[model samples]
Target: MQDTTDFEVWIEDNEPDGYEEIYTLYRSVAEREDNGIWAVTTNGDKTFVTGPTSTLQLLSEKARRTFLNAVEALKSDPEMDMESWYGYERNMANSKA
Candidate 1:
């Protein structure tokens, strides 16, 4: 597994109709009984998934590119603010709700 020191941007399909989308930054963390990915949305919603790798692979190409760019920026600047930097413009559409 890759080192998960930084949070990763992730995307999930909200429904079969493809009308809704959920975007998040996730980190692998340990829980009392098990380990999982802790996902936090721009809207401040929190969720969890058992397998981080699978969930990461599910992201769309555009989302994947955004995530990679964010990661690269973080590598250059350790103090970068993820919330503001990661999905700024993309989340504008989501923020309306």
Candidate 2:
């Protein structure tokens, strides 16, 4: 293992065609079954990694840079929040309802 001390997990946002932010997460405290959590990022946002630690440890650098945006908006953001950020408002289908 590279001992990233953190991992980024890719998440599919609002189906059809969407992706959530990437995140650089680290091993947090025990949750209960010893399945701690990915609780750390450079941007100050905290969220659950939503997958197994084994998967995270195996993530590639590009994957981490792409998915780790959830917590901390890393420098890799070439657009600088111009078009990178997406939210529920974009899901016009549900909004119309």
Candidate 3:
């Protein structure tokens, strides 16, 4: 997880206009990543899932579902079970398909 400092830097870089601003920040970080794919916006009910399409396409169907659910649990579902949330991401990363 990113620290408060990293989020502060992003806010300083641009006004938090909407999901596009969030996507720009996500893209910058994603470009540096070599593995894994997942995303979510932070706009209340208007929020949506997002991420690099190419990276997501590389995932197997099961992996894609796991990754997406993991991200959602982390970013959006505060009520989700902690054990389930972390295990899903761990397995998604370890899985070959």
**Higher TM-score: candidate 2 or 3?**
3
Please, what are the lDDT tens digits per residue for candidate 2 over residues 9-87? 2322211122222212311211111222333322222222343332233234444444434333433444545233333
Worst ten in a row by lDDT for model 3: 50-59
Model 1 lDDT per residue over 6-68, tens place: 234332221111111111322221111222233322212222232344333323434444454
lDDT value, residue 33 of candidate 2: 19
Task: List runs of model 2 lying over 4 Å from the truth.
Answer: 5-18, 21-37, 41-51, 54-84, 92-97
lDDT leader = 3
Cα-based RMSD of candidate 2:
10.0
Lowest summed lDDT across 10 adjacent residues in model 1 is found at 14-23
Clash pairs (backbone) in predicted model 3: none
All models, RMSD in angstroms? 12.3, 10.0, 15.9
- lDDT score, candidate 3, position 34: 24
